[model samples]
Target: MNGSSALTLAGVLVLLTVVAVVIRPRGASTVDFYLAGQRVGVATNAWAICGDYFSAASFLGVAAAVYATGLDGAWYAVGFAAGFVPVLLFVAAPLRRFGEFSIPDFLGRRLGSEKVRLVAVGVVQVVILSYLVPQAVGSGITWELLVGSGLLGLSPYATGILVSTAVVAGLVAFGGMRGTTWTQAVQFLLLLGALVWLAATVVGEGFHYGDAVADLSRAPLENPAPDGGLTSEQNALHPEEPAIFGQPGARYGGLGQFALIVTLALGTAGLPHVMNRYFTSPTGAAARTTTVWVLCLAGIFYSLAVMLGTAAREIVPTAVDDHPWLADLTVDGVLQVPEHALPVLGRIYGGDAGLGVVAAGALIAVMSTIAGLLLAAAASWGHDVYERHINPRATQRQAVLAGRVTTLVTACAAAGLGLALRPETFATATASIVATMVTWAFAIAGSALTPVFLLTIWWRRTTAAAAVAGMATGMLVAVAMFTAGLFAAGGLLREALVTPTLVAAPLAAAVTVLVSLRTTAPADVEKSWLIMHGTAADRHAERLAQLVLDENRRRRAGRRARRARG
Candidate 1:
């Protein structure tokens, strides 16, 4: 391990801990613990959401994908950014208007069924766990590369999984939503700064993006073979042609591309952690406004990630001449693992210090996302399950304790799963393993939740029974297809199986519609609709806040006048 890099990583973690402790909640109130008292401003919530949303997948996997697969890999960024657009248009305002601690809470209340709530809780857990494990794996990968040292006799990768999970879980347990919010916002800024610094350094080093792409396209893409050597990649889409670095057929083909995009695009609305953040907005309008800022910021962030990925592809090969250390990480001129693209680029550009910055950003990315996921899990278990079912009359303190306990348990489970995966064995399994794993979470979310979520928000006749059927069907179908994808041949069939959102989402929607048509609508449908879609509540809240501000200003003025007269 490099001392400078280790020091930088330690410093970043220390800063995060300080922020969490300083901003931790002061009360045992569930509102404060779960939703930050619903007072988060638009700008702050936007940044927190970006922090939560831009996981290791966005920071490491997106760049890695681009470096490995060229243009086709860029679809990850496009699909990710586009996912928020639907949230801006359909989910943001209405979700906050009908506010609750978690997605299960909202759906349970909306459908007026204990059964629906339980089913939603289960689905949310599945989505959260799927998303959480990949983040833990990403932490392990980053740690193995960054520090290369282990504690307690564990491997470097295992140590990272346990340490990051434990640290972030403890922070979430103590800090709750309020603390998590501020820290996430700050962490996002650090992440963005690191990316910007890396990009600037690359460009300053005389790396022209257009020239790089053109030059790479002239030669076939190569990667590390199974025996730890270089081999030319054959185009999956057009086997007759060489897999070029600037072309489309390197990673995905026609069907695979469409399926992957659909999975990511529809997944954002159903991500329990991301959707949970919306509940922190003071008003539905604020939630909508926050989404606008998120889109702008995400665009800038992903564009930089793509550029850096290209920079790594072009610069790293030539860099081996100067940095002999890189010879082990690369086969010939090609990187063995795509996930190393950004971190390697940082080291190339700024030496050990640069690597530390990029590595810290990556760890922060994993931790921030893990924090959000844990909170979401806590809300699902403590609020939706325990408070609503096991102990209806529980006190505020009891509820908060339950949430904390749930956070720890969930974190442990994710860490355990990460350790089981043993990423080192599959280091050559895919170009961007983190991205691939995250896509599974997206596929599940899109298939099982997104369709039903949209229908419940927009369709007044949606019933609890319909929701249960939709979620169960969507989830089962998607998981089954994903399992089938494991042994399926590599082609359009595997693409459809692996990324089944294209099929599963529509099937879920159709089932929901059919079941709803056959069943009677909920008795309080009109009331729920008004709560979800009307603007009167938002207007009244804004007016009350304005009056409070004005009253405080008047009191201040009067006090100043009296002091001057005295």
Candidate 2:
């Protein structure tokens, strides 16, 4: 990308941050900062969820996975999209109805124990930090490639980390959820539009999708290996045979595929940033309906992602032929940096200008996700730790101040870790470094939080002590297993450790049940059940959602009409 384009993108991001801060509600209360005042319409919230959910992992990693592993890579997108299904079925309405400011708040109130709340706060922080590091990594990667220079004498990577971190932290800390929500919704549209345009450009120009899939399937999936050579690749997918792109065992063998999918599917509900989004909905039913819209948007977005991945695989050699500068980066017609599959594809097709557009999308993906995660972190600290523990007598302004400070701190910490760690890619993951870390976060959340979260809502007998035990068990086991897995010799055991949801989640549920059976149930079991699953409550929520969706549609149509007349 040229300096002019780079500066333009920087200006755009700065303008967005300014707009977010400016639009924040004046004299914003704690509610506005933490939960967007609980008045977000269904459509708007759904868009924001899409923005929040599709981070660097979905934007760059999914395509890179396909670029690296063919059909096996498609599972990342599939698993991500599938996760919302469980959210709709088990978590959304009930959790929203419970109406706590944060996950710790809900668990603490429901189980009637400060212990439960504090324990959950630990798990939530782990999840938030795990998720935050990758966004920082993605930002640094984008800046290094797109801008290609350090800013203000910092290393390119550090500059990228600090610049994106500071901007997003400011947006969330100052603007809060109300500001972040609108900004996120707009960012999602920008990301979706960029991907759609890239897909259209590639497929429209005489690229036969069917033929590409057929060819990629017949060729064995291979990745570059370091053997002191320019081009030496080992089979990373389906090593025994030349794998088909659309078939199974192409990327993951044994039970690794199933474990990865289960982790992703269950993890969505456990994600603090994601679940917190439901709390922004105007009502329980609106939250539920917003989930439905999330599913629809996810499906559309992932399908396009799948196409882009396939297109990149088929286009790489041609791209190299068009741009000889990639000779050093592309070995045997495959990009060594799998994460570059999308932006490099853009660089191949449209020169520097094309690269700027796609790279901008990647940067936007990173920052938007950072904004959501920081807000969730703020809620975790400001609401769960500060208001509930440190300063029970604090006023609304004080709470917002706490949240804002926490946001800035979290951003700085995450950025520091991102630069310091710079985790190398795992051999068997067949995903980007950013994406692999995200999977670990998902596994931890799904294992540690989802099981307890669901049982707390669906099972009346769930006790505070049991919920606490289950979460602690899940957190320790998942973290221990993943850390061990990182150093273990590769095989089924390594895969299991890498994606521990299958084992961790069930163990947590079992512990919860056994403890609950031994202990007394939550005192408000009957009332909690009524709040979680009452028929009248569902009806009331659905009616309110219909009104919001109807109004949103009318306003959207009015804007379209006004644009057409102009």
On lDDT, the leading prediction is 1
Clashes of each: 0, 2
Q: For model 1, how does the per-residue alpha-carbon lDDT over 1-566 read when each residue is reduced to its tens digit? A: 55666547646664764575575555579999999999999999999999999999999999999998898889999999999999999999999999999888999999899999999999999999999998999999888888888999999999989989998999899889999998899889989999999999889989898999999899898877888777777787897887988888886778888888999999999999999999999988899999999999999999999999999999988989999989888888888878889989988877788888898899989999999999999999999999999999999999999999999999999999999996546555456889888998999999999999999999999999999999999999999998898678677888789899999999999999999999988899877887888779665775687799999999999999999999
Q: List model 2 lDDT by residue over 91-142, tens digit each.
A: 9998998798888889999888998998998999899999999888888877
TM-score of 2: 0.91
Best by TM-score: 1
Query: Can you give the TM-score per candidate against the true fold?
Result: 0.94, 0.91
Model 1: lDDT equals 0.90
Clashing pairs in 2: 217-244, 217-245
Candidate 1 lowest-lDDT run of ten: 422-431
List runs of model 1 lying over 4 Å from the truth.
427-429, 537-566
